[model samples]
Target: MAAAEEEVLGLLVGAVDQGTTSTRFLVFNSKTAELVSHHQIEITQEFPREGWVEQNPKEILLSVYECIEKTCEKLELLNIDRANVKAIGVANQRETTVVWDKITGEPLYNAVVWLDLRTQSTVENLNKRIPRNNNFVKSKTGLPVSTYFSAVKVRWLLDNVKKVQKAVEEDRALFGTIDSWLIWNLTGGTKGGVHCTDVTNASRTMLFNIHSLEWDKELCEFFEIPMKILPNVRSSSEIYGLMKVGALEGVPISGCLGDQSAALVGQMCFQDGQAKNTYGTGCFLLCNTGHKCVFSDHGLLTTVAYKLGRDKPVCYALEGSVAIAGALVSWLKNNLGIINRSHEIEELAKEVGTSYGCYFVPAFSGLYAPYWEPSARGIICGLTQFTNKCHIAYAALEAVCFQTREIWDAMNQDCGIPLNHLQVDGRMTDNKILMQLQADILCIPIIKSSMPEATALGAAMAAGAAEGVGIWNLELDSLSAFTMERFEPQINAEESEIRYSTWKKAVMKSMGWVTTESSESGDSSIFGSLHLGFFIVSSMVMLIGARYISGIP
Candidate 1:
């Protein structure tokens, strides 16, 4: 009788990891704590204009539902009952803003991607309106006054989109990050959807007060947005609602996190000072700070890491965001035709001993963290007659490492305690050459997890934890599920500093290349004159700087 009961009630948890370029669903067996089945589908990102990135909100929902269906089919094929899937968790791309109609559950427009720079002028406008010293928004919200956060995206929609403005006036506007949108739709959409967002996702919006963990009315009023449209803030790991539609209709939607926060939890960085860096389409570096909301003197954003329950203490983190990381490699593949496949970058880069005086600064969507330069564009400095595709490939990989090193420097300043090692995950960590470069550049250990797709696993852990089968389970040690490979620094500190200095000079030259006058004049002089001069001078400067710093006469 016990054996029959065991077969019938085999428990499992499902995670929906909705990322910038794709949607994936992963199912984990609670008893064994192992990934049983998974399915993924790429999301199409639409570029309607230069610097404007959008995604069809409805399509995002449809893709997620499809992933769930496919994953469930695989589960059934394995003889795992779909009904046994006890809970569903969600981890999504943060700050990708979505607004919709309250009554009909229809998206007003495409989701404004977090990487979109359409709101730059709007952010500037807001800054001009408010006094510089009195700009409490940053201190209160833990985010800078930039287009990266969600409130400006909301403001842009209200100011530009007629449909969104009309809906706001009619009190029919409904706003959410991707996770909240998915939760509302999965829990029955228009019928009786739960309108809510987790603390982690909410913290990225720039409208949420990090100290109080609530929506700031002053911020809403300042942005000219209606608070009626916002989702209710909730704990990261708790039952938000049950799925009333889709593949797992009856299962409870138990956990939700911003992808980076989910990665933190997935890495079991529950203790303060533990850090994790996720290398996805973009890279996000988050350092756990426990309960204290340590306001970063540096440009790093303070954010809610995760809240397991309503009564559980909130975990805060200082985060450094990289707008371009793995995406640069993708560009080399599709845009430049440097390599046929992303994995091919490793072999091609290995062909060269170093970047060979080349440095690729991928500011395609502008620089994030430390610099926060919205006007900057991508630049490849130090290219020469000898520079080959292999050199460019290596530089592209080095760009990721250099950006991460900058973030680590900021985090060290803010936290006062340096990270012992960087816990790395995501598809990009598979690059052995990149990992070694990361270690040498940062002058620190790079700990790569066996389970590279940690965003989904973190989501799964949150859901399973809510139901008491997570990290707390004695038999299932969270670390046991993951084996780790550590890469230590190989080069001397002087060499690392020299390389970093050259990278910094390249970054400095990349900035202010597009000025307001040039942009407003609609003249190619912005790129033709300023950008060309800067690139040439920067290339020469890097060569000189590298030699000087390395003590080479």
Candidate 2:
């Protein structure tokens, strides 16, 4: 009782969760790992083309500021001192590239989102540069050449946007993922802002060496990016800098992680083979692979799980992502006119036993992980006269489960250890129907965590683990806020296999349903095909000649 009282003095930690659709701030009592006060605001996405997605960088930062201010006001209303918030951590949407003028702090263009397919032609050109070896940079980067990463988006911005080009030429442009953008502004914007990104965010960029823990200059040249524009890569935990002008101005902005990496920490998947599947705007299934960087032969991404301190050994994980999950529900509500609310899809799906000979493959921005097919587009196959709105809704929900099953299969092949029970946390997990479907499809038990804000909790955990001054220790058992609900497979293995076989066929049909021209060829300053080929060949020749001259290994 005495220890509890002493611990309650000033041990709250604040987390800023800047996600694809919303920005939020939550305060957690480190003594009990329970949420105290929080606020959230929605952010809009601009879609100018069929397959493009963009967000305003200024709006994103403003959302963060408003969330902080509102959450602090709530803390005062509850009679809790805001000074109890020791540190602030940020967990942001990864791979969304943002560029700004360092001198003016103005965004050069709309932030190109992670799922944007505007770089499809750039990816096609990049793959052609390697002559059938699409994974040329995958050996060092542990990622395939896809429009899913930040480098391609950055390359697209430089090639297409005039303002970005001018800023880069003047040496006043700075580039980073959403986390770095948040950190730079939170620390002090244009006035001595620390431009840095954590290991997890850097690993998603395709410009970072997973082994060396630094930016890969050679790959930067291949992508035609300037190295000087990149930020300093840092570990996930430590005092990044002090919050510049918030209720917690002088407080240290200590922890940072990409959303999925933060979810891994929040799920407490500390041991190798412990995996968690986060169901968010998309589905990301990450299996902790421990310290060694285990590159996957099974089409999974090897990425940094987290680096706790400045000198701590990095932990690695195999990540496989699904491009569309919850967003599919939004599409159904707004575009298709099927459901009234996001949660109503589950109620509609429960009306049908199955999809009734239908399958919806939401390759809306194309497939990710296990099958990096950029040419693929959304498809709803096997539709019969028996199918109706309910069946379509059922198929859509099953589509999410089937995609996760594909990733789960790939993770098993890479790790050689099938998870006993898949741990799940995110907004989509609230659908008990989907959770059961996930278990039924994968033939594994599903353990859904009670934490609604697992990603934010993960960031808060990192913030409180900062050096000697922080309150929390980086351990599994220290958190008392976790509770679980177990979901066992209701269907037999044979039934699951038959349904999965149908899903496989639907996936194959979705592939190559769209044009491979990849759009915007004539308007791109993105290098002509012949010019790009010459550039690659010349760069390789220069690299070989330099190596020979230096006699370096």
Candidate 3:
């Protein structure tokens, strides 16, 4: 008699995690809510010009396919059947948009990355047309008029790229953040792929209304984006469609969410007042504020935590964003060649106990959150001659910690109840030194996630929940005891305050560095030439468009 075959004990949910630096697919045993197999491949970011970041949309799609295939192979190795994957989920880097020809399935142009500051002029002109306050759209969209949002990035593509402009005018273009692009291609692409986005992803575009949970018409008109090109907005979890091909073929693509929001779900923060922080290429801290949207008086963003199903009530969150986190470590690796690998940062940082009065503020594109200063540039202040690259590395780590501190304080104020401990995840959470600093700087306990792949797991959970399967239940009893590790604050609040104040002095030095003259001289493609006439003409065009949109003579 043949030996009995080993049976896989749990239902599997596959997740596609497309992030800034890379794309990955992970499989989880939803019954236990544990990540079992995974694969990831790095995506190249092309900088054609200074302050410009682009990624080939096709390459991004292909990475998803490759990751899924490799991960499925790993499942087979463990005696698990790939056909057991109940559903597929997606967790993508929010605001990084892709526009493509709906019928041809061809991208109109390289995707304009979220961090690209080519929209500086677009932001400046839009700000001129709107109210003086930065939070002009906060009441409706819960976002600001900034380069980080998808609308401005899409606007830049519409105005600058001739092919994209023509496509838009002809009604042949379909605009989507990374999630929509993937789902479309995954389902059928040219052969009738579903073109829709989840509520969490839709909320980042500055086009979606937080209250009504639909795309706003006035915001689209203000951004000059036609409503037709936008995707159909849906809740975070539902049966959007089925996978067209691959090992998990015919499996429902049931869930989708932005990265940080996915982390919020994975952290099991379904209750109000629970908060989590993610340390990735950028840093994000989100505090669930329940059903009602709480607009931040401070510079934090109000965003959707998650909408589990069509029938589920919407959950709102107060989010604080940091523009650069792990990317700063990448700078030391790539730009300075101080270290050969990104993870080496921890060892070098451990050489010094602290930054030693030196501070490194990487406002490279510009600062996000509490200080919405777009013109700010990076600076390494208080640098004595004795300051080595080690000190710089140490300070770089401290910079991320300090930025998290700023966001944490802002969240506490908005929620009116302090978060006792921060639930933290992401690649950066691996560095114990950084975790300790985060705890010390924030003067709170830091609880690191047991699942390092919280973003992917969250998407998986969403997919599983749609099928009415086992997910990380909202109840604490359903959680795995190994799900977290707590790091207590080593330093007192006074010392933390003293260190943070000095960091503030360095931050002030970095602001207002990008004036018109500097911008014109540095990034000349936007202005064509550094002339007063060119700027005047641009302003005139903006005024004309603004007046036309408002129906004002």
Candidate 4:
């Protein structure tokens, strides 16, 4: 009976994965490290105007709570007692800024999403004062000076939000990324909640010093954001606090990581130069550099991979992110009605041998990583009489590959060593055609794991490690069983190089197109304008078809 009780008590608890578009709660079996039960809730996005994307902070909180409760209910149905749950871990979207009143525990305004460009002007103004080389925060913090980070968003809130301003003036305002916000709420709101962020999440803010692993006062002053509002920085693993109430009452919150970093850990990329690419709303590739902060001379970012203890040197990484990967498929399905479902993209793409001469540069919300052009927009170029919907679909899939190739190139340049293979997981990787294309374009083997939910697995691993359920160096084969699909590079080096060359040309054309559109009408719907070009090309193809039918060449 004592042995039976010991076995039951060793089971893992539900980990709440608070993401950008949704929140998920997943329970894992500690012995096998497999998912037992899971639930998800979509979070709504509000685009008030062009370049302004926001989400209700309260809604995120509610969704997180709902996911945990629903997942726990499902667990109970399976006869798994909640008391057997050891700990709760959190993996959240990094850099989505939230500011709230420390007294009332209410958000001052809607949380500014990482994709939002509302703080563009603020970033631009700051850029003038802070040069990208000497004064840019990227050199110190391993992140770029973009509106995607929390610094500019936090500064924007303090300057614009009346309640936030009032709170700041009264010394009652607290600013943090979404993970900190959720942690604060989970631990019991403003009364006595611990305000903290993991090093991996903090590294993305452009305010934290990568070397020191602390918020840089110089950067804080440069952004005009008060340091008092910042949350205490903490390690990715270790007991941060205990849940005060609800479905996870009194459970220790043992692990925390930014979504991407957690996914890296989930993939078990423990060795230096081991990398993982998460194909989510965006595509991010992180290559661990182990203790060395290899700054990117290329347009990649340096970031903290994870921190195990306060005394442990933070693991570093060179990161490259493409803002439009899976999101491009979503756009093709929802906005253009080109496909019935997002997953159908691979099927449609495979129907065509290639994109013909067409190329789609999906710089929908500005380019990131290797190309840090904020003004760049989407473009589908080189359309001809033979171009069809299948070609367009293929081009869309190729866009993800091309962007990932750029990331791999930048990563190699920064790290001075090329990655042998890329470990990939995420919903988008389920598409075989896309994974093959990724491998072909990258000129490297792509490893698609059996478990697509690496983010949640990473969180669970961190929690398990913290609780002494597993060692960090424990064999991944013995832990979470993973079967990999290896997509080897089939194309020759010359062909790959030529394809990348064409991709770069298309990227330039896209960037120039954006500048042209902006200068002409200042219209923010740049994709709409680019689509008009597609229409015009389609009409030309129709005229050519009529001529061919009339016996003209």
Candidate 5:
């Protein structure tokens, strides 16, 4: 409407970051390479049974809409016209599978979250038929046979979900990860929706051939997923489609990537061996491998980092992911009542002298990357009567470092390259003590950017690159504005190795605590004390509630 408003609006390039725990929208000032306005909404996590995690696809869609509207409202208040939103970039949680009706564009069942392990049987069956090392899918897709990937989850849905089965029989079913689901909805859903996914996301699906850069029909058949339900594979940066209707209408959706890959881009780790570790619901470390895909001999995964354009050379990455990181802190807060808030863990941890020989192995949903032990349960070893809440808090933080060290070791063994430094981002990186400990444990410098929203920045950069804006092409002078904190390794190499050895021993002891026979006999000690702590805290809260009900302060 006004000239000033139009100028402000023109700077809006919305980035929709659909992550494991939440959906966020960030409006970026492309000119200054800064976030002008943003909004985030947490999505619901449904645990139907042990080791089964799910999320409603429709709820995700609603959260996306809410984020977009809230972000646009903030932009408007800043004198930025919502009409100026030029493009939308999407970065989403990888390997979480969703199945929907192709004709109706309605999800047949809740999205089977990446953390879900209900498909372990399916993965085990496939693994039996194909040797772990010589598995053609592993050689092509750079992934191991695990329930963490999308293939098994998709197969389980088709076999178990009745509506999905009906849709597949009628040839009206469509399967996608969160990225594809969001893009389909954002672009206009069944009417003219594009059933496509970026190469980075596709590579993690296990059904896609990383070498061929397309869906593997044989693999699809092996998993019993129909090829027709799969999305068309595309590059990470390109005009997939335009926003048909929203707060920012007519804007092209130019960039898409799996959340971890996007974070790598956001951290500006463009060179080989450059890596970034994102600590969120889970911790994912991705090391850029340039054009070469080095198959992991050390339990790491080889995956597509990003593809710039159609026919352009695709970048590969060696990745190691830890399934629990910041979530452990939430557990300490909500379950154990060790702290009133998640943030307070860092403070309490700082107050403690040390972990005092305690080690917390957070394998609540089983260990990931390098270990791949699905049956492994969490344990806290070396606990003594002297152990206090601070000791547990410190041990929880140290657990993240220990898991990261394992990943880093695996990456080195897989790639035959040493890392001198690592770029870090995400909410947990704000803890200076954790960063220092990460540096000391990994024996490498940990560098963190001032802007913790690296995932959103990465998606925006991909969108800008696709549009020829060169948002990432900044000079060192201008790059100084991108603040970074570097934490150098403080411990000696021998000391680091000794501590690591102790941690490995602790992990080994934690793994076999719960077995099939023991579980059936009701002798499973998997979450015994930990779960008891939760119940104790709940009962305490109930007592407090009764007091409040009786008008007691």
Candidate 6:
């Protein structure tokens, strides 16, 4: 009977994926690599002002709690013993800032989402005070002085929100990303809740010194953020605390990572030069650089991939990002009313075999990696009378692919090795046409896993490993066999080059859209070398096309 019970109580782990748009709870069976039970709930985004995206911290917590309850109820309905769930791991949207009361754990203001650009003015002001070199902060934290990071968000809150300032003055303020907030509540809330963040999440905050693996006092002082309010940093995989409140109460809360890093682990990108691109609200391309933090000469972030346990060497990555990917599809559906649903964009795009001379750069919040042009704005060029919504939809999808190609070129140059194939996951991978387009443009096979929830699976893997679940062990290579589809390049190199070159022209038009007279902003030149990466590849083709078209040398 005991042995029978042992078989029934097989190794399992739970993952709470708190994303930009939703919260989810997923349970995984480590032995079979199966997602046993899961639940998800959409969270609302509030845009109080232009370029400001916020979410209620209370709502986020409630949504997460509800997801856990519903998921555990599903497990009960399936007659699985809840006790088998040994640990709960978390993967969250990184850089979203939340400042709460240290004693009450009540948020002073709504969470400043990673996408929020409210700190643009703050960033400009801070830049003057910091060392004049643009790479000064990057040398210490591997991130540029930009509004995209948590430190700037924290600074904005400290300056703007009176409640946040009061909390800080009263010594009651607590700062955290979504992962830290969720973990604190999951552990015990205000009552001895462990205040901590994993290394992956910490790396996103410009406050953290990636080399020293601690919150830099200098950065904290520069931002006027009190160190007392910051969460303690820890390894990506470890028993941070026991789940004090939940269906699986007392189960150890063992693992946590920023969503992009989690997807890297979930896709099993464990070696140098191996990479994964998550097509989420934004597209994130991460290439693992093993133990070394390979600073990008190209516009890419240096980040921690994951640290499995305390005292383990941290695995680092070179990250390039697109400010918009799936979000562009959402904008077309919600804002433009071009499609009824995001999935419909794919079919609509197929209605037109090509973009029909249209090229769209969805630089809604400006371009991110490689370009790093915050002043840039969205642009759609080469539109003709023949072009319609179908062409526009196709162009939108192509924008995602083209942006990816640009980043991949940077990763190739930074790592000094061409990636033969790309591993992909997230909401966007469901579109077969887009995946094919990605392969065609990049000229590499795009591999996607059998399970789409790579981010959640990564968190579960970390939890299971910490709990000594043999099946969740990282050493096993069998899990790599779970790849469901591989997209191979279908277009000829010449045609791919032509499409890419046209896209480049559209992006060039998008650059420097915002000038000093329009808004008190300065422009920075886009970084690239004529000898290497995407620029060279696209430039040669464009130059050749120009000469051929004009009948010149």
Q: What are the lDDT scores of the predictions, listed in order?
A: 0.84, 0.86, 0.84, 0.81, 0.82, 0.84
Candidate 1's C-alpha runs over 4 A off are 1-10, 467-481, 516-525, 528-553
In model 1, what are the clashing residue pairs, if there are any?
none
- Per-residue C-alpha lDDT of model 3 across residues 35-70, encoded as one tens digit per residue: 788999999998765566889999999999999999
Q: How displaced is residue 270 in candidate 6, in Å?
A: 0.6
Find the 10 residues in a row with the least total lDDT in model 3. 528-537
Best prediction by lDDT: 2
- Count of residue pairs whose backbone atoms collide, per candidate: 0, 0, 0, 0, 0, 0
lDDT of 4 at 12: 65
* Model 4 lDDT at residue 371: 74
Off-target runs (Cα >4 Å) in candidate 2 are 1-10, 131-136, 476-481, 521-553
RMSD of each: 4.9, 11.6, 9.5, 3.9, 4.5, 7.3
Candidate 5: lDDT of 149? 95
Provide the TM-score for each candidate, comma-separated: 0.92, 0.92, 0.92, 0.91, 0.91, 0.91
What is the C-alpha lDDT profile of model 2 across 1-553, one tens digit per residue?
2356446644789999999999999998786678899999999999776678999999999999999999999998987778878888899999999999999999999999999988887888888787455555888889999999999999999988999999999999999999999999989999999999999999999999999999998899999999999999989999989998878899998899999999999888889999999998999999999999888888899999999889888999999999899999988777655677999989888977688887888887888988999767676776544556677788888999999999899999888877778999999999988999999999999998767788999999998998854688776464745778999999999999999999999899877745545344423223222222244224434534434212233
Residue 167 accuracy (lDDT) in model 5: 92
Model 4 scores a C-alpha lDDT of 0.81
lDDT value, residue 25 of candidate 4: 92
The whole-model C-alpha lDDT of candidate 3 against the native structure comes to: 0.84
Q: Please give the lDDT score at residue 510 for candidate 2.
A: 74
Error of 5 at 215 (Å): 0.4
Give the range of the ten consecutive residues with the poorest summed lDDT in model 5: 544-553
RMSD of model 4 against the true structure: 3.9
Worst window of 10 by summed lDDT in candidate 4: 513-522
